[model samples]
Target chain A: MSINKLAYYPGCPSDGTAVDQDMSTKAVFEKLGVELVEVEDWNCCGAAEVEDPKVVYALNARNLAIAEKEDLDIVTPCSICYYNLERSNKALKADEALCTKLKGIDSSLDYGGKIKTKHVLDVFVNDIGMDEISSKLEKKVNVKVAPYYGCYIGRPPETAFDDPDNPVLMDKLIELIGGEIVPNFNYMKTVCCGGPLMMTRGDIAFDMARKILDVAKNAGADCISLACPLCGMMLDGKQADIEKALGITIGMPVVYITQLLGLALGIEPNKLGLNKNAVDTKEILGKVV
Target chain B: MPIKTWELDPNFKNEIMGEAGGERLASCFQCSTCTLGCPITEIVPSYNPRKIIQMSLLGMRKEVLSNPDLWVCLICQTCTARCPQDVRIADVLSAIRRIAEREEEAGNLKIDSPRPLFDKAFQHQLEKYGRLYDIGLAKEYYPKKEGSFIKGMKAMMKDYKDFGMRMFKKGKMGPKAMLAPKVKGRAVIKKIFKEMGEE
Candidate 1:
């Protein structure tokens, strides 16, 4: 595990609504003695739209430019943010024309597209090393957890951090960092969370998450560990609406992956950014801690 | 939250995302496992990881592609992998993109998309070198990057920082991409794409 630092890309969620998530990410990171540098003037991860490849690239390029300028590997907390940043970085790196255009827009920026972007969980597992995190485990969240990686980061390892179909980083991180991951948890291996919030037509998105939760419930997972903010917002935010809408209850709380790390590191739940979560982790932690 | 509304086909709402992947779409159960699993969905609100599949199932092809979800996906396949029901979220989006591109090129559809140009540019790169080269692609993508001082400065600085910048090119990886494999029948691969209606 590298002891020095983590170049952080808080992205959209980390600043406000996901502040809790951000806090915990910092706590765990600090506990590991890693210096965290926020990506300066980082723009959105092209989250709102993909209309202009030019604009989209510019947006993602802005973040990459910061990462390159600072000469630090980026560690984003949100899955979607991580995915887009890394994906765009990968794409821009490949299409020199795209990178050039992006560089053109930012005349003063050095947008070389060589910086490697990773999810916070990735830094924990890869850079921090689960073994170190495991060594620091003062307490274990015996809570049965279904580690949810979401889509963007894992698969297309070329673009993101790890393998999509069978991701072991989070699984390993959870265990080493002092938590339990349900190995055979049924829905642990699935796709998007009713993507883009079929919220209006939520019947589509709702049903998808509902099924996975059911699988977790069936598998006895008291909670699910997450890497993406949208994943948390949707799963945690909409859990009640989904439960009422679907006439079922998962009772399974959704918590940020970093929060778990913080807890393991003896960082209190509240200070570790547990508050930002839509679904409370209290009961789950109560049972585990 | 500036909402940019467009004049989508009047028939858009009446149709559903194609049924090919609808049942799986219906199973979304919204664990957001897909959304959580989806890396792109985290950054961009414009692209809905789950909605396109639903739109596809609803046969809302026009709506789905035109939604920006098609282009924003990054084709990471995370949505499909995270989907419990095994919904081909990315595949459905890919098909929608294919249809949208065909429609735009044929002028049957008018989309507020720079993606067509992006796609065309990508195609041109593929055709020229049978692979996408970053240096060449950059010159092709942004003309300003060619002779500007900022471009020169950035390029030199980037090269200085990351030594591998020169070798950074799309589709230049994996043994197969570097050299189009010698198939037992190269004609077969050609025929498949041709029959599949790909160039």
Candidate 2:
């Protein structure tokens, strides 16, 4: 049977600073005739902190239960959120002691271990397949884009769903939408996106963002795109800060991976979440289309 | 060396981590794997990952509460992948970071962390206008007389012409996109900082 509906989890960033990310993802998915069933009553997955022994797994545990109620696996676009939830779910399944601990916190929420989680990159690469995605390309984006695969998705390969060392979810999505991938700009593929910087330590967050942009710009990439909103928020939402801090013109069109596909599928920009970005993607796309 | 007794910032140890990572209680050991394998550390050695978890574990509340190092970890899995004890080294670092951000915002934590010349010059563009306008981030971050400013402007001008700025002016770069729904918590953010001693 053709898979028509996808259970989606838009992490905290999607609800806030990274809203455009979800919109763009859906806009393209909508055109592809794939419905996104957003996980109901979902809570924060506690990102990196859920793994601590003293910390109850209940926080990250809540999300998997929500996905299970619907009897469907979840698809997340944010790599950090995806990694956290996937990590928690994987751990819960492997360790009965962890499950016993979680049950003690919320006896009502049993760890039946029925949920499977994947980043949006996984759904795009595995479920949708490049052939179907390419068939929907109404327009071609000629920009030389460097695909930015942040750490959460690629480093472990468990969450990668694609090639870990040099994942091409970003590039495959671009090609599916008729964009040219710049083959050479690949050094910092598994690097951080500074999603951790928005809070008290923004200098380092912006520092990481500037480094990625430095490489992208030098490689002559017209744009940099990704699936993680936090990463996108760092690179796409914080472009000006990077320039102000570093005194470099690293103003490539930092966009969500799906936004590129949405454009090719004839989805409008407003629905794809481009309005809130720090970089002027409208300016760059203006050159391509 | 005997381990130091960590006196966690009550707000941070109890409220921040509890709210953030649910009080990640002293679970990390300093293997230097996070620092050793961290890609950011390779690029910038000052970006330490192991020291961060140690500070959080020791509950050196003030130090971790005001740390600029807190926000630098990319959540890149370098530390998460290497921890032999199953300590979520990266996430714990980030949870502490989120708490520090609140501290900085509330004005309780007065810290000075230098950004690179480029990021210092233009990060405000994203925070304010929500899009990167090269012309704008540059003006806001740098003074025109600075040699770096002149050099950056020249680069944009050169690239613009090379990429067909004249045609670009006609509006045809790529797909048009939109922003997503704003997360519901304008006051919560303010309150978190205020609770931490921000005005």
Candidate 3:
């Protein structure tokens, strides 16, 4: 089904660290003629760190309840939010007792678990369709793009829309924009970027990110295209840190899937917040523009 | 490194199964798939998911709950996705961590990692503003240790100085970003916390 509208859950980081992702996503959707209505009074989705299942359920159910009221499928760019929201929705639907407890929190907060929570990439690849997206591309991006899926978007298998082990939605989207897919990225594509532990375990996180960056760099890719803000933050925002810590030079530019899409669709670089990215995109942009 | 049979708490497995996301704890047959696919084990060889599960099943409640290695799993769910027995290895680890958190609260144990501290700060921001306030999170997270404010401030700056400067230069963090508005559902957030008995 082609969705013309969606209840957008921007999540917490979108306003600050991931502002570029938010802007680019909105610009891409607007260019595609899809209306994105913000989820009314949406709260945090109780990201992965929250171990208490009840708390995770309560926090996400509140947002799901609000989106349900909008009577539209919910969509978010952050994979962590997408995982928490979708997992909570599925759990709430299966467990009546948990749903009853959530209702006790607030009568209006009772989520029917009816709305489908989707990653923006899922919306772009499936709902929006590859043909429609390819038709909208105004510029042919002549660069080797390594598509990074990170972890959440296609893990735990049950909630994934694409193949959990070997996802190709982002690669398909990359192809749609006339970008070449870096060879041999399948093995490292879905490898964990160590995002959840980045703040607390910077050593391990940076090493894991370095592994992915090394794979991309060795594959001769011009840039990395991804969907999640956390991955972008780690791979792009912290690329310099990884280099300093590991004493290796990896100058891969990490661009969000939406930003790349927006670029190919003729959106201005400023509108896509291209300048906001930490790793310079001048090299890739020069080839495309 | 030796297992004392008498020290094992047989009901520890049951305790784990009682927790949410731990329903399938008993289903694990030690296929070692979780440990194989775990990215952390590759980096930190000492942090092994299979060993953790083996210890839990052997009834090493105190050892399992208080183990500092528990905090290093990253909760990436790679193990959960690959578990042959459908043990939901990641969720099982979360369940064990939840127990560990409770034990720490009761003064029975101590966690070495600053992850729990960060998690609390994250929750505090969620409860206060209905969304994360990055500046507020930093303020709450730092200066929360057993030290003077100056020490905590120094540590925070030392860790984030270079990264913060880069983010600032790129316009990702600044005064305007600092003043970003909070969600309007603070009341609802408070109620949710209260309902979940987390408040």
Candidate 4:
């Protein structure tokens, strides 16, 4: 397999709440022959809490500016980071004054918008191509996996890499891995997981996540596969809390898309950080072999 | 019964239009597609993205700006993606948030939720660490730095007593959360924040 490369921007949550995502992404990408070089001196995408648009642009621009020097398109596993960085890259490319203003923030940094920002799914589906990935799969995952795109990356026309209404990239990847797509999951595919509503309004966030879990459960999904860390944290990390709050049992294990792919590639469940998941992934893994 | 007057500040629309991604508000036609598409409205009845846009356009500045629901928008962009008129409902809500923040800072407006304070603490974390250090941000978030420090401190402790222990056991927070490492280019991050008037 020929080595492919990407400037990986493993967004904030990957450092802690979603370390399993970080580990699985690297392991799976490496297994697929894609080398993810951490964008040198990269910082946060500032998440959504930062309300100022200019500051959002500047924070993401700094990351892009660093990666442009590397001469490789930036890729992030986290959707919100992908959205924020891509949004900044587009904004700077269209407005010289904005780039100049961002540059003024740091005299040493340059913001020419020279590189592209890609979500990991884009690199997997479009760049690497499913045909290449399919050829490497050791075994097919036979269980039904619900593909959740969440709400961040696949939105706001210019920055969206796929259809905002019905994203099929994950579905394609799941198919490539020989995993059965949850047919009834089409309705809940792009719904908001209530990430931002978590701490501020726990009830609303929990209820929103509960609704998604209910949809997936009703679809008879064996597990849920997602890209964004926040969504993973919401569905996986908060599953118990949500269950307790809503007085409903949502036993579905939420796994990273990379982890699912890694599993299909015959990577050990432990190596894919399966144990790091809050909801037990053992049941789903038990069905695999 | 006497009719109640709506104190409409005509500048609200233009003020929101001044911000980035806010220019799309002109195209909104009250088609209610945004409302229909929003997942938040399904759960939280008070958070109507369409109504908020209508109110903002109507220049109901005081009503729109001070409402706690103003801070409730998830910025998920579902409404933005579905808006038939190309109205970026999420971005418009963000613009309203910015205006609300400025007003609150000036003491010209009052908000009922602690979200803004948490957002500010988050900003401070970004300014200091160039990334979100969850434990660091949480520490800054709960404790009252303003009026009624003792009461705020008690509330923060109560919260830690309530949810903090469980979060730590779940591996979401604790020594690991506190171990949120700083980004490599700390100086550059500080410079960007300072230059952007974030400091």
Shift of residue A149 alpha carbon in model 4, Å: 1.0
**Poorest stretch of ten by lDDT in candidate 1 chain A:** A48-57
* TM-score of predicted chain A against the true chain A, for each candidate: 0.91, 0.91, 0.97, 0.97
TM-score to native of every candidate shown: 0.62, 0.66, 0.97, 0.94
Tens digits of per-residue lDDT, candidate 3, A1-289, equal 3789999999877876788999999999999989999998888888876778788888888889888988999999999899888889888999999899878878757999889999999999889898888778899788899999988877888777777788999998888888999898888988999888887788999999999999999999999998888898899988998999889999999999999999899999889989999999998888785
Residues B18-86 of candidate 3 have per-residue lDDT tens digits of 888888988888888988888898989888888888888889998898888898887777888888888
Off by over 4 Å in 2: A49-56, A287-289, B1-36, B42-74, B79-199
Share of reference contacts found in each model: 0.09, 0.17, 0.76, 0.61
Q: What is the Cα-based lDDT of residue B73 in candidate 1?
A: 56
Which order, best to worst by TM-score? Answer: 3, 4, 2, 1
The Cα error of candidate 2 at residue A210, in Å, is 0.6
lDDT top scorer: 3
lDDT of 1 by residue, B41-144 (tens): 54555567666655544455555656755565544476665567665566455556656777777887765644444454443443344223334433454333
Show where candidate 1 strays beyond 4 Å: A51-54, B1-199
Model 1 chain B: weakest 10-residue lDDT segment is B163-172
Off by over 4 Å in 4: A1-3, B1-7, B145-176, B197-199
List clashing residue pairs in candidate 4.
none
lDDT of 2 by residue, B1-199 (tens): 6545633443444554564343443556676766887867865677776776665555568877666655455557666665665566655664565455556658787545422233423333322332233455445434432346677566445433423242233222222212322223323222222232221
Encode model 4's per-residue lDDT on A1-289: one tens digit a residue.
3338888998887767888898899999889888889987688897888877777888888888788888888989998898899888888889898778767668545777789999989888888887898888997787799999988657977788888989899999888888899888887889989889776777788888988999999999999999999998889888877777778888998999999999888898887888888888888887665
- The Cα error of candidate 1 at residue A235, in Å, is 0.9
